[model samples]
Target: MASKSVTLAEQSPQPPKRLKGKKGAKTEARTTQIGLFTVEEPEPFKKATPAVHISAKNKALTLVQHKIYNALLANAIEQDRDHAGTNVGLSQFSIALTDLVDKVGLNSNNRDYLKGVINSLIGTVVNWDFLEAERGEVWAATGLLSTAEMDRSTLTYEFSAKIRDFLVHPQMYATIDMRIVRAFKRAAALVLWENSVRYEGIGQSAVIAIEKLRQLFLGQEGAKTIYPEYKEFKRNVLTPAVREANEVSDHTIEVLEVRQGRAVVGVRFTVARKQEAPRLESVDSDLLMSVTQLGIPSSEARKTLGRHSESDVRNALDYVRAREAKKGATPITNVPAYFRKALAEKWMAPEKSSGTKKAAAAPGLSITGITEEEIREKYRASQLGDARAYFDELSAADQAELIVRYNAWQPMQKWRLESGKKQSAAAQQSFLSWLAHETWGEPSTEDLFKFVIKGLASTATA
Candidate 1:
């Protein structure tokens, strides 16, 4: 296709954007009519700036991570104040914050996330003044805390309490995302630790104890709602002090939140303390043995021994040993001391013993065979009610009769009565009145009869 030679004009295609500036550079610059030399320009400058590089989802995740680390650090600071009597230093705070962030933020085996968090924190903190100024309006608009009163201790308390209230309530902080709740928790911890330690001069141990106890409460079996700082005082402060003083490790520091006459929230501390090891003197072991036969809990038996001096234990043991030694030929059983005393009294007085035996054997709920003291125990739990209410509702004669029947002559006489015997109408009314009086006017005769009869009949049938 060799075409006829013709003076034909050729046009060049425009260079692509990537090559535009460089491509024209190879051409020589021609002088224009104005005699000024023109040259090609370099690419536009893109000024570098600091910003988080992440998608929206990752940004949210990063904020949550920061909150958790911040919370742990604040809690640690609060604990230090409680135990050591001073606020944590900045370096200590930084180390703790970094440690927690490393533990929870990075891949379980890496420190990359931790380093990033630390670096970001340094940068954020370094420009905090400027950021606060610029963000002041935005934060105030957020209605989390008032910037105007931020420095006041009362403001801290009010805000912290508000956040806590939010966490506890379903309408306030609940509408926010779970991540926000976590962030608020961390922020609240920081505010609380600062307010209490710096302004109130509360100790660190108290705060730590409280936080640890709070965690334990969250793990309780039936707990519905847990306050983040609920147990801080009990666990961090009270338990440690008490544990130190008691020389025992089994005691607990408890916080109870009561509402409408019922416990709504409770926090308990399972604390360890340095106790003086139990030193068993020769007598202590014997006393323990004697109490054991009586069915005292081992802990209580140990406590009884621990309370007494070594000399007293020896004396008590000597008395027990000698008594046992004298009765060796009879081979006395390992009965309780009180039981032994009763047996001795019966053995010593044959006539009185026979009378006691007759009364106990003839019992229709009578304390005759048992001691007079035993008779009193039968009615104590069954008949007693609110004293004031009972007296208010009972007639003077009835009150007198009740007191006489229960307490007259040390041991009142018990009349044998059958439960199934039907009473006349008048007698039934009287019985109902007596039952109402006994129940502090809470139960009418019909109600009492129905409940008691139904229960008894059901149990007997069962």
Candidate 2:
């Protein structure tokens, strides 16, 4: 009998088409179509405690771990509507390991490294707290990924049902560039980025009490006694984080100290987008060389040049040099100070007339006997004495809270001193005004200052 002939269709079926890697290893199915979904923006307004708990506490996530967690959340949110219920945890999705590696901007050669990150993420346990009807509530859960498995070259994970609402259905969220998140090496900077991004359009300035900031960055179980010295804290934590954000991210941040008398109470940060790149001019090596010759440090000169236009620096340098050339002119005792003042004030030419000897000097600096340094020191001492008196008048808890605020503010003051800048009176008054409002309802600015320093002598005593 003739055997039935078998066709190719009746034999083995072909595998789905997949992109190939360098080694010809099969990757996930390639899709040329653009993805039409919005990354579920994280709700920045939600108390940062939960995010901090997940990101910083319980074995802080490595860069890869952070990226993977984010990637899962983004993918889950994109597929949320397609799944049933408000729970992203109920929705399961699979991402090709190769696709994920590419999306996170990682090298595909190190599959083992990616596996380790996945394992760590699966093993992490997060603890968080919530308020239920004015009562404290505690909740503990596993990492963001509830279940994860690897099949072939695909990574499959489900979002934690406990955090589903917080992750996807946020009341208010921040739309951050994942590219920026991937670029951050330090966890502190990423935390700060999230904190600041939420307040982006609300106002140019954002203020966070020191205690809250600590909780946000260090987590609930982190050391309370750490960063005891404000200077150490600034050097180790604040400056580096702020610098990274400003350098790589779209936002420009200026940290300001909020003082209550002589002690720093908090920080006020002004965030703004970087100005558009200005029209370029031919490099003025001559001006830079002149700035160095005029006793400005080369590093400082370079920074000044970068900040101001060459024409501006050149004009300022010319004015200063011309003044020095005058026969009777007092040689500029502080060349760096002069250059800084010139650049700051945009001084192009000498004043037409020396109406008064005092007028000839820079606005803040003095000509005859006193220096700006002396004036600032005197003002600082007075402010401190006033703050101390006000601090003493508060109740125990209030005083303790004020001390925490002071701890936060001290670093900022030290930063200003190290940078050769003085804290302005207006900034101090703003802090005092905020304090007064917090302490005893709202009061007029004059009333606030008067109450804080009432019955105290004006004399500054160490």
lDDT of each prediction vs. the true structure?
0.29, 0.51
- Which regions of candidate 2 are displaced past 4 Å? 1-55, 82-89, 127-142, 204-206, 224-226, 275-462
TM-score for candidate 2: 0.45
For every model shown, what is its TM-score relative to the native structure?
Answer: 0.17, 0.45
Predicted candidate 1 versus true structure: per-residue lDDT over 175-212, tens digit per residue: 11111123222222222222221111111112223322
Name the candidate that leads on lDDT.
2
lDDT of 2 by residue, 1-462 (tens): 111112101121222333446634323222222111112221111223344334234333444566667666655554443353544344577777775765555535355566667777777655543111113545555565677888778888876767766665444444444555666766667666656654443223345556545545554445255465666556666777798888767677667887779766677665544542311123355565677567553334545677788778877887777777889877766665566666666676556224423233223333357554554444444455444455444332233233333323443433211111233564445455434333333222333334334423444442
